[model samples]
Target: MVTPRLIVFTDRRQAARPLDEVVNRAIDGGARVFVLREDDLPAAERAELAARLGAMVAGAGGRLVLEEGPELRKCHGLADLVGAAEDGVDLATLSPIYPTRSKPGYGPPLGLAGLGRMALAVSIPVYALGGVDSPARVRDCLDQGAAGVAVMGAVMRADDPARFVKELLTA
Candidate 1:
């Protein structure tokens, strides 16, 4: 099974442009993986958005994973990762690999060392999420054994989302 090298999480509220516009530009820039994290919206609304984005991503040889989707499971720490792995999840995200504003008080920020340990502990593909806002950081995550780097505010808030994504993927 193939694993994404860069997974972008969407937060429409954080996007400087329309969600579809940003996603389209990212796709044009070679982004192939995305995650929909719009739990604040109504279920029907979220589902509709997911379906629309799924088609767009699919057209670009990519995929969109919904936060509440059953196909993939997301986890925070090693223990959760272990349990998710046992459940045969398609993939998982292990987060707060660094201090992040998005998750100000989610928990103590899990440093790179913690990320490494968690990545090794999980049998499934574990994506490094949170505070991966730069190319160097993205590379750090990969070096630490993450299957990919999952980002949210980076692309969402970038004035040039496409360029940022290209840089992140190449990094």
Candidate 2:
């Protein structure tokens, strides 16, 4: 199957403008999937943010995925979210699959082989996250059965987020 498109992990708070504006810009910038990962905000606030952001993204013909947090608690994050793509959420992002941006003090990196095993247990496409600094590694992730790779600092903090995404998507 053809890859849907680049999935951007957007930090609504990181942008100077409102969350809706940031999301609109991201969609305009060719971001097909957005993971609403504002961990600092409360659950209710996150839900509200997701609703607004979701509307803006859908208006732009893009998609939004709400991450409940790193632990996938209380119906927050889950692989099942992919099934709700039309209803608002789109695809789950299982992070720290290898030492990720969220939890640095966590256990050892869940190497690709181990990650593949874990991903096999789930039904939806899994995006390998954490420590992804090279686009070539995308092949390894896909080989290990990952749907895709999600990067934080590797893309957002890059000198060129667009170019970084191009390389990652092409990889």
Q: Estimate each model's TM-score.
A: 0.95, 0.66
In Å, residue 32's CA in model 1 sits off its true spot by 0.9
Q: Per-residue alpha-carbon lDDT of model 1 for 1-171, expressed as tens digits?
A: 368888889999999999999998888777898889988999899889999999999998898987877756777788889889898887888878888877777688788999999899878888888899999998999899998888888888888888999999899
Tens digit of per-residue lDDT, candidate 2, span 1-171: 224535666665444455565556545556667777787889799778888888877887766766654322111133434333323433344456555554576557777886577556666556777677577777788788777776654555555555566677778
What's the count of clashing pairs in each model shown? 0, 0
Best TM-score goes to which candidate?
1
Residue 75, candidate 2: alpha-carbon lDDT: 17
Off by over 4 Å in 2: 1-6, 12-29, 42-56, 69-90
What residue pairs are clashing in model 2? none
lDDT of 2 at 131: 70
